[model samples]
Target: MPALITEAHDSTRLALSSHNPGAIEDFGLIGHKVAALADLAQNYTNSAIDSSELNRLITEHFPWWNDSTLRYFPWMRWPFKVMKDPSTYLKMLRHKVGIVIPAGDGNARETAHLITTLRNVHKCKLPIDIAYVGDGDMSPSIRAFLSRLGTNVNFIDLTQVFDNTLIQLKGYSSKPFAILASRYPRTILLDSDAVFFANPDDIFSMYQSLKETGLLFFHDRTVENGNTPVRQEWVGAQLKLAGRLPSAHLANNSLFFRHHIDEEADAALVAVDKSKPDTYMAMVFACWMNTKHVRETVTYQRLFGDKDTYWLAAELTGVPYAFEPWSSARLAQEPLIDKGFPLVAPVENNLARGPAAQVLEGASKPVSQASPTIAAEVLSDEKEAKSIKLLATDTSSSYDKNQTTSRVEAPHSTNELNFPRSSHNREFHDSPKPITPNRRCTTHMVHPHPDGSEPLWANGGLWLDKRDRGLGLANWTHWYVGSRNDEALKTFCETSLPTDSPNSKSWLTSEDGEQWHNEVMNTQPRWYSNDWGMDAEGCPQFEEWRWQSLNQGFRDRLERMIEEVRKVEAAWVLELG
Candidate 1:
């Protein structure tokens, strides 16, 4: 049995009131000295402290740390406590890690797109070792693409580690599990649809914050205005019942972490159950981690998709995060060259080719592989010039022709044109363009869906048919009037369009109106493809100037269509009749 010893510290000496030979006899005055160490054995975590610091700090107190008996002692695990080779701790922290899940059929195409773009278009500068977790069958395209991308990618079949029980519980949805399984101490989990405008290395700047908190996430908004946060109490109740962390709304899918969620991981399956409504797997488990309180965390704003899941994660995590109103530009359609107007041509129609095809096709090849003749093909079309504006506009005003030309000059090469440099600067210029009458008439200028689908035109608004009827109206009103109000035309821009920002003016100028609709809207999902409630009669006629200026002629034609639709709806009866 060990004897109890009283420890006392003085200016030069440490004295024990009572003695315990086993605890202190080995080091004459080192009992207090050993206690001052950073406790790597019990509290091993990622940090700059290496074996040198460990040796320096320990040797100064107990110079016999390397003694065969002292070194092998279970209690004094030393530098190996944190890392087997403590010298490599800092180097491990710098190794880029990508925690990716290429699961589900929908993600197959997205997986190909991500790897292809990251390697070719975005040109990821970081040396990321992508650790993919999913069934091997789920990502054949991704695998093929990865082979072309060279040796930095890693593929892990879920069956290799997880037993049938965990795998059957829809484990593919558990982002935390996938993250924990990665070999890297620090990992970044990005969604498949995530498009990168810049190098992913920029994300490493948050490494300190990630290391400090052990976890970090981003905040995001919806594609249109349809997303509204669910009741906080409801989200809390679901999370608490399922054992998760309570969040404000949703946590962005783009997660960065220095640790993994291995403890009680099996219990986390309850969060991913398909039966539970609004129970997002990532949000549920992240919230659960918060309850454990072993890790520090922070969150910031970055744009993303899947609002319900992402928003719930943000709300439950309750980490300090930033929110940016406009952080990215989205994909849009290019008008058909022969038509001399902006139009979303059908994907199957050979004659309906647009510059967008060139952007995607050329994006897969390196800058040197592209032909100058192919680049000229993009610039030669008059409509391509307008499409380039959609890619780079800041505000609604007409884009500078010179600026648009410069941006589209080398369409075959991703490096030459930054693509989204915002051709229309957000500066509100003075223009006496008529508002309501012109806006109403130009409804014909609204481009048809790229795949020959008709838009959901109903009740004074264009609906994308996203089921949330208000979303269609809100989106159209925002584009037409430049305000977020559901009834923006009736409220914010009631009398006339405001010239300032939404807070001050609450309305959009003709230029401000054009930039978001033509450029930004194209980037969102389904807008350019869906056929929402179209008759066999086909889409509206094309007129470029009407869409460009919102002139009086376009408004007159659109008003007639609005009246025609109202008359048909009023005369028609329900299916019972």
Candidate 2:
């Protein structure tokens, strides 16, 4: 092997020194220009050589190429002229692989988790190298953990390099900056949160296919809308701002393959370092490179969507890409396999359990039997209409009087009776009563066996229909439970608290029950108002009534709206907090 000619650490100095008249430069005064010219000549020579002689030489010495010359670039070609032989350059490229991972103070737990998981679970046939760049002191715990993985890993502190510039520009904590800075050609930059979901053989295979194409970028399924040709202009603007590439190229960075190592590529990398060392700049740089001669690829997985701001940066960059379907419909069509590996398992225990679960549990309950008395009384027409009128006339009074009392007397209340405390209570106090016009009743029957056991229902069991009243009560309870202010607290106890379930009455307590209720109420409503916004005229009522309802009727309509807002808030909090 020809001895490797390592380039200077300062690439700009190397470029400048190559043209300096005073000191001698090893690669000659022309620097990269000379290298480019030499490559052109070698390519020309290889192309012109006689086929018969060339075939004989290649067969005897380079049997790998006997099958196809297209597989190997001609050594006498334009690009190969700088190198002594094409095989030598190709060997150098093949042996070196770039590995990247993000690290920092907040991300340490997740980052460590990812590294450990990758080391233990992911089995790669190739002896791939690993590189980690992040912020903060290299924790001995993480360093030692990674060392045990049986791979050579390099750690670079991003904060030391940027001098807080990155902190000011993008406000990203150090870990992400280091990862973006250390990216090299022909390397795979994996995010700390990204677990190896499958054997990456095909992923690597795709990378190899882009060898001639320059850089390869993975397409996220969710962010593909930004990858459309029209979005390329926006991507180009970012690249131009970074001074890496002129307008016309775009790139994204969920997953990417870097092919060619050139000055422009180097410039792209530096641009990423200087201009907000986040995923977007990296994406823009990639797009700028692709506009020249880079190749890009994307998977069909929806998991790759650019739903986040970092993802937005990538979509702006125009590059060759593909997207894999990870959408609900697509996932349903081709379900995941449950292999021994954690990646394909049905339950991913590796992910951190977020606060959402706690919030959900505190706010919700599984389907259970509705109180028999309320079911019967509420179902009756004369009693039901009277309750509706009461609600319409004075919702606050009806809610406050009934919410706690109904829960306490759940077993005795009947479908024909209005809840005892409200104004409508007298109408159904003792009557079997006619069914309400629009109101529906649902019955839930519990059976007891003989042998002194409870008796089962002989005829068709209790029928239960949708309950708007119950939902309204639940919403009110939630609002009060989540009370950050006096009004919300009042609303929860008086308007939203469920009247049918005695267990739900705990929402009125001053203990952990109240805390749980408040968090659930607070989280969803604030998230919705900030993300979706309520109209000004009804904003106060919207805010108040939003948390008071827990009925299927209200939940079915608002669940998606709530989730969307929550997701946006969650994304911001995860990165910012």
Question: Model 1: per-residue lDDT, tens digit, 1-577?
Answer: 0111111122112222232333311222122222223223223233332234344443444332332322111122244566567546444443444445434444433344445545554456543333344544445554544444323666655434433242232323334434434444445555443433234544434234433333443221112321112222233344443234423212221111100000101111111111111122233233222221111121111112122333334333332322211111111111211111111111222112333323233212111222334433545544543333232212113222232112211122222111223333322111221222211111111211112122211111222221322111111211111111122223323334344442121122246444323332222111111232221111121111112222233233333332222221111110001
Q: Which portions of model 2 miss their true places by more than 4 Å? A: 1-90, 125-138, 159-184, 207-209, 221-577
Candidate 1 off by > 4 Å = 1-84, 87-91, 94-96, 99-101, 104-106, 125-136, 139-145, 167-174, 206-230, 236-284, 287-577
- What is the C-alpha lDDT profile of model 2 across 121-168, one tens digit per residue? 344433332233232344555554444433545565543343333132
Best by lDDT: 1
Q: What C-alpha lDDT do the candidate models reach, one value each? A: 0.28, 0.27
CA RMSD of all predictions? 20.6, 25.5
| TM-score per model over all chains | 0.38, 0.31
For each of the candidates, give the backbone clash count: 37, 68
Native-to-model Cα distance after best TM-score fit, residue 269 in candidate 1, in Å:
22
Give the range where candidate 1 is weakest over 10 consecutive residues by summed lDDT: 256-265
- What TM value does model 1 have? 0.38
